[model samples]
Target: MELLLSNYQPAVFKCNTPKDYMEEALKICETLKIASGYISSDALIDLKRIIELNGRPRLELLIGMHYFDGFTKNQYEAARTLNAFLQINDLGFVYIANTLKFHGKMYSFTMIDATKSAVVGSSNLGSLYDKVSRQYEADILLKGEESSLIHASLEEIITKIGSPFENVPVTKFVEFNQLLENHENVSKVDKDEKAGILRNLTGVKFEIPIKSKPKSNLNPYFGKGRENQRGYIAPRPWYEVELIVSKGITSQPGYPSNQTFEVFTDDNWAFKCETNGDYSKNFRSKDDLKILGKWIKGRMEESGALKMGTPVTDNVIAAYGRNTIGLFATKDPSIWYLDFDASK
Candidate 1:
């Protein structure tokens, strides 16, 4: 019997506004009928907007925060917006953050799964860095089996990490204390120390850089009235490429360093380099070179990079020598080499 598998479709969006992101997401929501979402530190703002625009309806929402001690007034307002949305929709929302306790501070990972459709993104729900970043930087819409998995996971997490505010009824003045007590992950420090760490980790934490927009120009071949341009007028296909570099620690000190750079086409298959760089510089001995070579060759063989039916061979490597070497170290003793088309 033939086995069938479900395809994964992950969208990468480059957008400038919350509205645009929401519209795109809403379309996905309508198509997939998403029932729940998990929001990390960055996606809370847009999540709130989505809930509000969709008539403040109940949905499964799980919010995760790394730290909460330094949130500003505007940031607090964003949190209020989120709480209001949850209240009106009668939705389940979970806020996870590190907090200080009267005894000892602890960090907690929280979750809330009250709705079916869910969204996750890389934006915060506040004005903490308004001029620098959007309320939401990016979003991922989860549906079908994946959506169900996320919901279940969040629910399980929340149940395990019981909330302090679960049954408490408190006024505004005591709400902060409630949050601190409820969110086990929040930490407490003096004003001076908090400011110092804030300054030190400014750009390293949660600061998404604004990407410059590419200049758009009309294609000469498909100008204005040429809406139905045929054949070669189609846009070039996009390719996703990755380069991975790693070193072996288990082997002796003289063993060669192993590095791999892979180029993946739209098709799933990858054009991989099995052994095309020098490891002698780091290894400093022939034994290291041999060990590294053996290790790399095994990996390539396992990946079918040097398979019998495959067209890629030492010839192809020799042809791409310049490009391959450019990706690795220059001073290594063993030059880039390949041996292909060997009988099995």
Candidate 2:
């Protein structure tokens, strides 16, 4: 057994990530079985491409988290797309675990030679290659007889509780959609109560640092000048702010993959946002890139925390009290909150 840590602590020690193990398995293993509590659209698409590249080794995915918070609307669509891919190729299948929220990250593989290998860890497929909001994870790799033992266990788990993804209940999906709408439909609340609601029911919330070089005019807030006739940069609307999401929030459910969606900020700014670039790492306003930058910097400017023509470096964000902006997701998928309060 070998322990895998995503952080790669102690440079000299030499470590491999859970992602590395999965990647290797996909490439060489003839059969790969995975059970994960969560998955994201981009991760599934990326996995699909890889499996195709490696000759489509049989792969089965068992999804296990519907009992708690169900999938985002986008995720449901992505899963359908993946199901089609699986069906057309007859390579493998996806199952949703209805008996319980299968929270285990287990991977078992059978190589061409019939030898087996297995991995058990905290990583979901979404976390394996998440560039933004990268998370630290731990997993163990097993081979030889140990791998064979885990393989049988995986089959047993599937037999006991797995249901085809196609067979997953529509009500399971509708429940989450309704939950979000309920949050949005709240009649009224005092300022404090509203704040409490946003914070308390948050699905996941984290701080995102606004990164910029100390001397360059290239702060995401400022303009990256073009040396042509258009030295003048354009202005934007509705407090634009773009952030790289970590641990595959875009992959999770609400945000969806590569599609423009509406989001209302805690400050009451409404805008359409999209995730772009490789692995959907670059997040910004769908219409213009500057919208995201303007939104965040505008808040600082309004609070006298920032001024135009000044670089938004680490010190500036620190002086403003927090080096990162807090993004909170409510049960309402379309509603989100932004926190610019001082860092506690």
- What tens-digit string does per-residue lDDT give for candidate 1 at 72-163? 32233345556555766666453433232111111111122333344444433332112222223444445445466555655554444333
lDDT of 2 by residue, 6-87 (tens): 8643432367778767655555578889888888644665465555444566888887785366775545655666667777
lDDT of candidate 2? 0.62
Model 1, residue 47: distance off in Å is: 4.4
lDDT of model number 1: 0.29
| Residue 8 error, candidate 2, Å | 4.6
Q: In candidate 2, which residue ranges exceed 4 Å CA deviation?
A: 8-12, 171-344
Winning candidate number (TM-score) = 2
